[model samples]
Target: MELLQALQDRRSIRKYKDTPVGREAVEHLLEAARLAPSWKNQQCWRFLVVTDAAKREKILAGFGDDNPGKKGIAAAPVTIVVCADPAESGIENGIHYYVADTAMALEHLCLAATEMGLGTCWMGLFNEDLIRKGLGIPPTFRIVGITPLGYPDQDPKPRPRKQLNEIAYFEKWGEN
Candidate 1:
């Protein structure tokens, strides 16, 4: 699929079918993430894929009941725990490159999922300590985010977005 079409078709899916995501499909998404550019090519990002039901339950427990993606987490056949090693990246002008690099990789993962006719929802708000302990993640690694990947069960309309004029400027910040 074309990049723009994939971008436009992508949505934060909260519902999934009782279907399994094949290992090859999972690998394809990972390949896209692996190709994403990182600061100094250090590749700080790491993906922990959870497919077991019991483990998914544990991850869900870390999320609050009010989390919008709770149902998706429970239903998805795969959930990728995105982590980053801050040591692999640097900080410039108070900006952390580790997060930026990881985020770019996550976007690659999500877009690849969309192009493959799969669904994913980027989840972030949760108890990090619980996730780190439950998932046995290293204390040094930062959990950048989690995203449920599966076949979508619902067809959602596109959400609103800011106009280009409102976000982009011709020459200056305020010049729309």
Candidate 2:
């Protein structure tokens, strides 16, 4: 698919079918993430692919009761846990680069998933501690986001976006 079409059409899918996703497809998605640009090529991202039913349930438990993505978490064939070693990305001469590098990689993964005819929802409003413990993630690694992946079951309408002029400015901060 063309890049612009993929970017415009990708939605936060909250419903998924029962079909299984192939391992090759999963690898392809990760490969896209791997190619994402990072701070000084630090490439601090790490991904955990959770396919086990019991573990998926555990991850779902981390979501809040009111989270709309709760069902998607439990039903999707794969839940990718995107993590980052913060120290590696931003620690240039003892400075923290924060989450910029990790965020870039995740955006790439999301776009790639969209192009591969798969659905994805980037989940952040969840219990981080529970996820870290449940996934046996190292204490030093930061859990940036979790994306539920599978074949979409719903065709949601696109949400509105602000006009370029409304949010963009020219050379000056307030000048369009």
Q: Which candidate has the highest lDDT of all?
A: 1
Query: Cα lDDT of all candidates, in order?
Result: 0.95, 0.89
For residues 45-119, write the lDDT of model 2, one tens digit per residue. Answer: 999999999999879878997999988888899999999988777666765664777777878888999998899
Q: Which ten residues in a row have the lowest lDDT in candidate 2?
A: 90-99
Evaluate model 2: give its TM-score.
0.94
- Candidate 1 residue spans exceeding 4 A from truth: none
Point out where model 2 deviates above 4 Å: 91-98
Give every collision pair in model 1: none
Residues 79-123, candidate 1, lDDT per residue (tens digit)?
Answer: 999999999999999999999999999999999999999999988
